[model samples]
Target: MNLNFDFTEKRVIITAFFCMAFTIANLITVKVINIGFLGMETPAGVLIYPLVYILTNVIADVYGEKIAQRTIILGLCVDILFVFMTTLILFLPSPAYYTGDSSLAFVFTQTPRILVASYISYLIGNFVNARITAKVNEGKEYSSTKNLGILAFSELIDNFVFIGLAFVGVFAVTDILIMIVSHWILSLIWSAIAQPFTKMTVKWAEKGKPAEA
Candidate 1:
């Protein structure tokens, strides 16, 4: 909120907030929901995951690529650690009065393959988004706001990497096709939503600085 300042504590707090949201979104989106009305499937994380990428892109495009890269690495680490912790929590004892119940246990199965896929998908998708955003903004004096192309490109990278790593050979071609379209369309909407917020953050970051002075 303090646009005129570059306080270390402030940046740290904000960074932590975004990182937590991204990590949590990764956790809860493991369930693939089939829409009852549209007869379509989509990631529960779709509601929040693109926002994470949008944040990283803005960080890379505005502050610097180093920051963006660090954010991705740190975010991945947090997500990985949290998942393991959650698995452990589930392993802990429930009340002795209740016999073992498989009803909910199936959801938190914590298979090795699932863990590996999640890690790979998140890292690859996030890194790709950061790289593209930074590259596109490179050598430009000021932000151009004409970044709709980034939406499509980011979604493509995220979708392909995630689909290949996580869902490859596990689903039909038609299923993959649906995912691609969903990611692309959702990303476009997300990018549009984030554009103004990103511009504001950048301008604030540049505040108190002269034009090339």
Candidate 2:
């Protein structure tokens, strides 16, 4: 059997690894930070969430939809594993000398509702982003603007589902709506700002591609 250690394939694998890490981290610490001003509040994860979309777009653009979907699934599996491991640890007794169990639990213990919401929202958002990028750029040169537009819309749906499902009964309706809108807008803006970097990464991945010859 022949093996190919192609640079582009390695790039895709590395990007997918980061995507999985980011996805798990985003889910766990999403509720950790609360930024509020003028009567509006949102999770701190919004700052890094856009990167997942950007990476997904790059994968789809450089590789294909099949690879992008595989990455998403791998991420989802890792996220689930993270949740299980954390939950298991929370159930075990902490060391007698360790006084940070409370703090650890505060950060690691996720409610079932939030867990479900996160998984559903993440799968939907990532798959949609991949699909849109694949379809938009199919047999055509990649366009950052088009990718950003599709990502923005996908983020909107992602925010709506996650926020609505996670906080519907916990927060007031108005606050929930505000969070959805704010998160969606922030994610879109972040993606737009990161467009240059995204493009650069895609270009880097596509470099030295045998198929382009």
Candidate 3:
């Protein structure tokens, strides 16, 4: 596929990717991965989930906060639709020969508590990230580190709310807190490691075009 070089097309592409990532993350949250070195475990979805925030920040830098917020709202709607369709399919009757129904249900089923946690955390975390990133860039030029504080603060909120809601009473409070802190740190590390590349892309996209207010 040919890449679009136009700024407007780039913004659209990024927004599309943001929505896709959100949906994919939710779908994969059923799998857990062990972190041998840390003697900890986490959902496999955590690995790519951080990219959603990074892409949001990049969109905020390139297109502006209003666009970022709208894009996030769009993503939220897409996620809702995804959940609805998957749940419907999971409950639908399957043909006698269809042996994959169990696998589909296994991969797609999510408790109502988890669904709430996912939606709440996603909206709160992403909007805060976009708002802070935009506020920091007001009357100033974009920089890779400009929104570092936003990432840390908002990501912590994301993990805390998600864990507190989904796993509270299931895990000890101390263990829950540890999970939050560990996830937050890992997310920050992922974003920080991607900074240089993010900076380059933003710089290229912002050429001859000032970010919207």
Which candidate number would show the highest lDDT if scored against the true structure? 3
Q: Candidate 2: give the clashing pairs.
A: none
Give the alpha-carbon lDDT of every model. 0.68, 0.79, 0.85
The clash tally of candidate 1 reads 0
Question: Which predicted model would earn the best TM-score?
Answer: 3
- Best first by TM-score, ranked: 3, 2, 1
Off by more than 4 A, model 1: 1-7, 33-38, 97-108, 139-145, 208-213
Summed backbone clashes in each candidate are 0, 0, 0
**Tens-place lDDT digits, model 2, residues 32-83:** 4555556656777876777787888888888888888888887777777777
- Whose TM-score is higher: candidate 2's or candidate 3's? 3
lDDT of 1 by residue, 1-213 (tens): 654455344346446866887876766676776756456677677777777776776667665678888987888778778777767767788887876546446655556765676667667777777777778888674453545566567667767776666776888878887777776676677777777776776566545544442
- Stretches of candidate 2 off by over 4 Å are 1-5, 27-37
TM-score of each: 0.80, 0.88, 0.93
1 or 3, greater by TM-score: 3
Sorting all predicted structures by lDDT, with the top scorer first, yields: 3, 2, 1
